[model samples]
Every structure is written in C-alpha cells, then in structure tokens.
Target: MKQDIHPDFKKVVFLDTSTGFKFLSGSTQGSDETIEWEDGNTYPLLKVEISSDSHPFYTGKQKLADAGGRIDKFKKKYNLD
Candidate 1:
C-alpha cells in the first residue's frame, strides 16, 4: 500500500441510455454533472450506451443470423460443397 500514488476511487452513477436505468458504483473517473441517487446522495453521473439489462445475452433477445440461408453464399464464394 502506497500513499498519494493511487487514483481517487469515488462513487459514480451509471445511466443506461437505452433503458433509462441508473445504478450506483465506484470509479476513479470524474464527471462534470452530479445527480441525486436513490441513496439520497449526490454523485457523478456517467451515461452508458449498453448494459446487461438491454444486452442480448442476458435478455435472450439476440438477433439471429440467417445461418442456413447464408451458408450457400459462403459455399459459392469459396467453391466448397
């Protein structure tokens, strides 16, 4: 453990832009804007493009690729059976 050589780990709020969800966590990053979190304290707000809530894996809403149909395209180009 060293003194005065570590980043300033502070509380930050992550705002999911797509779902409008907010979660509080700690980070070393700083922000110009502050928000009143559910804990009734003002913290730096950071906007994120995607999170598990809106992500395809956890939600099982992933976009399915046309595997069978696209196989022909790949075979024709590569000249494979």
Candidate 2:
C-alpha cells in the first residue's frame, strides 16, 4: 500500500440538524467546524439533515404510501384495466 495516498480517517461528530442529535464516528470527510464533545475533546463537526435518531423508519412513524390510489391513478391516466 502506498503511504499518504488515502484520506485521513478520523473521528468526527455527526450532528443531526433537524433533531440536534450528535454522535461520534470515524469518517474520512473533512469539515471546517469543530465541536467539543462530552469527552472534552475537540473533533470535526459534520452536520447532516437526517440521522437514525430522527429517521421515520427508525422512529416507527413512517407514513404508508397510498399504493392503491397510485395504481388507480396510473390505470386511469393510461386507460388500462
């Protein structure tokens, strides 16, 4: 393996922007922002729109799509039985 050819994989804090949830994980992504974690250590801050903390599936609040309605609409649009 070549040296210095890979991205710097380090610990980064992923903040859920919507829910304000934060967690520490390793990533190769870089950020200009820094955040002091609960451990009193500063790490790169990566803001994400959604995370498992606030995701619909994880929270069990996902809305069931109206598949029947969509099928009926499609059939009507194309005049298919």
Candidate 3:
C-alpha cells in the first residue's frame, strides 16, 4: 500500500436523522461533529437522510406507486379474477 495515498479510514458513526438510528462503521469520510457511542468511545458523527433501518426496502414498508400508469395497465391487461 502506498503511504498517504489513501484517505483516512477510521471508525465513524453514521446517524439516521429521520429514525434517530445510529451505527458505527469504518469509512474514509470525515466529519466535524463527534458522538459518544454505546461502547463509551467517541467517533466522528456523520448525519444521513436514510439508512437500512429506515429505508423502504429494508423495512418492508415500500410504496409501489404507479406514476406512469404502467403497473395498473399491466395488471388490467392480465385481468385478475
């Protein structure tokens, strides 16, 4: 590995703002904020809009919207009994 060629990979805390969910992981991303984790360690805090905890797919609360009317058309074409 080349020295100083890679961004700093360190432990960081990712915060899901919507769900108030937080997790710790290693990343090259840096943050100006800090948070005390459950392990009693301080890590760089990175705030994000969504994560697996709040995401539709992971949470199984996905809303399948038929914006273009294609899905509805397809279902109509098949003719459900």
Q: Pick the TM-score winner.
A: 3
Could you give candidate 2's per-residue lDDT for residues 1-78 as a string of tens digits?
889998889999999876779999999998999999999999999998778987898988863344338878998899
Query: Candidate 1's C-alpha lDDT?
Result: 0.83
Q: 1-81 in candidate 3: lDDT tens per residue?
A: 778887778999999876789999999999899999999999999998778988898999964444457777888899952
Clashes of each: 0, 0, 0
Q: lDDT (0-100) at residue 25 of candidate 2?
A: 99
Measured against the true structure, the TM-scores of the candidates, in listed sequence, are 0.70, 0.70, 0.72
Model 2 alpha-carbon miss at residue 24, Å: 0.2
Checking candidate 1 for backbone clashes, the offending pairs are none
**Higher-scoring candidate on TM-score, 2 or 3:** 3
lDDT of 1 at 45: 90
Q: By TM-score, how accurate is candidate 1?
A: 0.70
- Estimate candidate 3's alpha-carbon lDDT, on a 0 to 1 scale: 0.86
